[model samples]
Target chain A: MIEFKNVTKTFGKTTALDHICLSIPKGKIIGILGPNGSGKSTLLKMVVGLNKANSGSLSIDGKNPSQETRNSISYLPEIDYLYSWMTIQQAADFVKSFYRDWDEAKYKELLSFLELKPSMVIKKISKGMRAKAKLLLSFSRNADLILLDEPLSGIDILTRDRIIETIIKDYRAGDQTILITTHEIREIEGILDEVFFIRNGKVALNGDVETLREEHGASLIEIMKEVYSNENSQW
Target chain B: MKIANGSMLSTLYKKDIMSMKLENIIMLVGILLGHLYFAYKASTGWHPGTIPFTSSTIFSIVLFVILLGTFSSIRREWNNNTIYLIMSLPVGGKTIFLSKLLTILTQLVVFGGLSVLLGILSSLHFLGSDLLVEGLGFISKYQLIQELLKFVTLLFIGVIQIIFVAFFSSIVGSLFKRFSGFITFAIFVISNVIIGRIYTEMLKLFMHLHIESTRQSISSEFFLAQVGLMLVISIIFFFLTSAVYDKKVEL
Candidate 1:
């Protein structure tokens, strides 16, 4: 449901995405795997219309990303984006007012599943809980596309497992498309239908996990090491 | 299940206002204490002249708060990374801009209205109603109402113009990755200068065209025409700034 044609984004002298082109199909769980500064987050941000591509075109579902497209794209950025003064419930209500796809039942279910109290203030909550809160808000919406940028980064292993479980439990295969970016491959490798290994703002390798394993005769993590080692570029 | 556009706008307006609740309360308390202290002083046989001076100072403080709030409201989003949430919303840039503008205008009206009322009441209490009425006796009540309306219109237009300038400068500043604060301050100063010059020229043009030989001072028609000109400029800036915000500003 997302297409990037020769998209290149540069911040000052450093290029974030370099003339990269890729197509992400609808209703599939896709993992965009890369190390830090590998343009994974940049690619996701471009899809969500937060970062504009400098040269090439990017579109979702045959339409350009804009305010209207944002309705269908639920994004969980790698930052604390919620207001500090708001409780999780207040933030949910504020977000719910803007989206028609908001599922109250799903929200409450995720709240309990995530072990997040509705009355917990965002500022007072721990980082892992805040990440869970962000995930809750995102998953609450029945958006056609969900972009999770570094959701597992800096999160504890337990919280990360819970987050991964949250994704797997609520995710409806063939109904919602999820594009997640992270270097933490082993944890998410099992859930991903397809994986794209990005390096230095370019796609180094991508394919279906099963097909890739069959062809390479190795696990995704071993394959990741092979890919990075074969490339001369510094990580 | 989606809300209509009007409701969305109202929801955004409410959120903006809610965000400022703490600042509003602090301002309210400050104004209240100022009034009470002055009231206490007035009752203790203090000089009458200090009442008007102190009341005007309070009004100035309110104006200062409005101007500062106009800039900080937008900055707060960036400081807290909440702009990510705001930009991700389904609403366009115009809605975001207008909601903020509406919130500031609402505060201006509410706080400004209170200040004017209290100022007049305190003036009356200190100076007595007879003297105040005598001062106002020179003009008919209709003329007085007309003048009051004109003043309010001018004040509103002026404040709106400043808000647009501040918004434009802030947006322009965001275009750069470094030294954005200096850039924003510089743009603000330059924009105010250019706008102030244009405003002065426009006022002069209107006054010259509308002035009559029989008139000793500037006519009310000139003020109305100037207010109209300012309003049009503010609207143009509003649209331009909103367009930039929509297509250009990157989060």
Candidate 2:
């Protein structure tokens, strides 16, 4: 479980997150929906301890997201994380040595499933392959929580479905929590149990995905469009 | 369960070595080849005079290798955004810093040991030649060993100094983010100029103070003491770098 208590993060004069409070429970797929600059990335970064909140506190499993907390969490940033010079096998070896809970069998299976060559340098891989590599690394970890920022962002529809299916298959029931952030609402709608819509640096709506869809009499995509339009109407 | 700190440290040290990509082996081979070439050249009438084949060359090569190894190790991690992965590990920042320092020291020691062995072999090869027999008689092996030991120690300290400077530059670059490359270049140029000017001024001051004494009056002990002081300063800088790196926010 993760909790953010009255968290506020500011960059110069602009506020990235403003006095937001949220509690995320375990064993659920949570989707963070927001437009560009809606502070989705900032919130996730704070939860992972990459970015410090200007004023409040964030805790994962009752401990602050320090190095110790990080051990229990896997994070996949939108940007490429694999080193340009490291081959896939070398990267795997390096990462495996660092984590005590590293599952070598799972890692090898994921590599094969992703069709990644062991000796291939990450820089030479296509973007889709790189994304798969990142996914493999994150999913292979026996972590209690996983934070994936825009995992489906530049992939084709079929690849996106494959990625989603991979994640669903690998999901460790009742032991792992996953928080995915993206603007592509429909792509992940069926997979997400809970949805949080962020607007103007605050959580505008947060609830069960099915409940919200039924209440609004629309799909997640239509609801998101309506929410963004409503927020912009005030501006 | 409480983890034994020693095992954790050893694990981190091993990881750091692997991350360095066998830099130590490459340096050892490079140093051996360089010294062997120089030794062969000196013995084959390439240079008629006695070659300055001292332990200092070995120490210099080891120091250079360590400097390059440490810089590339840390710099590559930062450039590749691997610092996030490293910092996010279960280890504390202090442990990470100590592991890096240990890795750098171990690399330098390995390279230094290899260079010494190669240097001795090269010296023996040179001494076997008839042309160098006459010159070799004048050099005292005991004195050479002592001087070499002192120079090796000094080189170790110098490598530490270079590591501190590189670490400082990395922290600065990380802070500046987008302009870090340009800032690091400018800092490199300016720092060299500043150091050169300071060295000249210090030499001038020392000369003025000892105007009455002859050059012969100044002993090797004086130079050794100066190097010792530099080693102490380098240690302080190393600690400073570790402190900054531990607390500084990653951009």
Candidate 3:
């Protein structure tokens, strides 16, 4: 489980993440939904030790996300972070050398699923293909926690569906936790067990998806639209 | 299967070397060939120079290649975001830094050794058929061996200094969000200028004091000892950089 306690992160004078306190348990798919500049990415980065909160503590399984904590967590940044000059095989080998739980067979299977040639340099691939390759590398690691920021932002509908299905099929349950941040909530609503709607720098709304739907007679997307629309109506 | 915890440093070092491309090898070879050609031309009367100067120039060229290659390796990794992957491993930042240092050191030694071997071959050719007799006449075999050892030691010291500068620059580059390369270069230049000024001032003071005996006492062994101390200081600075990197907030 990952917990953020009174976490407040600021950049210059603007607050990127307000005093946020939340506990995410193990074995669930959580979605972080927000529009641009909503601090969704900052929150995720904080959990992975990429960003330090200005005045609070974040812990993964009761431990701060130090180098030791990072060993158990796999993170996919929102950009193309792979080395451009490396062939897929070389990248895989490089990653495998560092990770103890690297599943070579699973990595190979993911490559075939994504239709990526092992010998091809990453810079030569299209954007969508590169995204798939990144996903393959992150997923093949048998980490206890996976944090993916904006995983489905640039892909088409068909490719997005494929990625979603791949995540669901390959994800190791009970022993692993997945936190994904994306704008496309409806596409992943079926797999998301919990949802957090962030506005400005705070959690505007958060609850179990099924419970919220049953109580409010509305889907997660409808609630988000209503809340955001009403907030914008005053302007 | 997992890589054993104890051997992780060696594993990472080996992988770093394997990741080098054919292009990098070709560039190293090109530099070596260029230096060798210059040495041959100077030694064979195509250019004018005393034997010691020619040898020293050849040695300096090799040293320059080693420094360039080491710095370029780190720069390539930084440009490609390979450092992110490297830093995310279970290994400590110190281990990763040390592995890279060792890798660069090994490459420098190998390249430097090859250049020395080429220099010896060229010298033999230039000295003609009485190669053994001429070498014996110039210096005793034991003294020649000692000089060769000193040369190797000096080359190693120079390589260590370059590594220190390169690693320091990389840390500076990674610290900021914008114009990192420019900022790192500026820091390097300013620091070097300050050090140079201090060194010059000390030399002037020594000359003014008429310390002839002090100047005469400085030998190759003394120089090597000073360089060894500098290498230790470099390692400490590298450790500080790694600590900051491990805790830095990446955007």
Between candidates 1 and 2, the DockQ winner: 1
User: Against the true structure, what is each candidate's TM-score?
Assistant: 0.95, 0.77, 0.84
* Model 1 interface CAPRI class: medium
Q: Write the per-residue lDDT of candidate 1 for residues A70-133, one digit (tens) a residue.
A: 8888999999999988999989998988999999999999999999999999999999999999
Worst window of 10 by summed lDDT in candidate 2 chain B: B211-220
Report the C-alpha lDDT of model 2 over B62-138, residue by residue, as the tens digit: 77667666666777777788777676566665677678878887876677777776665665565556645645554
Residue A201's lDDT within candidate 3 is 85
Q: Each candidate's DockQ score against the native complex?
A: 0.73, 0.33, 0.49
Which prediction has the highest TM-score against the true structure? 1
Docking class of 2: acceptable
Which runs of model 2 end up more than 4 angstroms from their true locations? Answer: A12-14, A108-112, A115-121, A230-235, B1-45, B50-69, B110-151, B178-239
Candidate 3 chain B, run of 10 with poorest lDDT = B212-221
Native contacts retained, all candidates in order: 0.80, 0.36, 0.57
Clashing pairs in 3: none
The window of 10 residues in a row where model 1 chain A has the poorest summed lDDT is A226-235
Each model's backbone clash number: 0, 0, 0
> Model 1: which residue pairs collide?
none
Q: Residue B189 lDDT in model 3?
A: 72
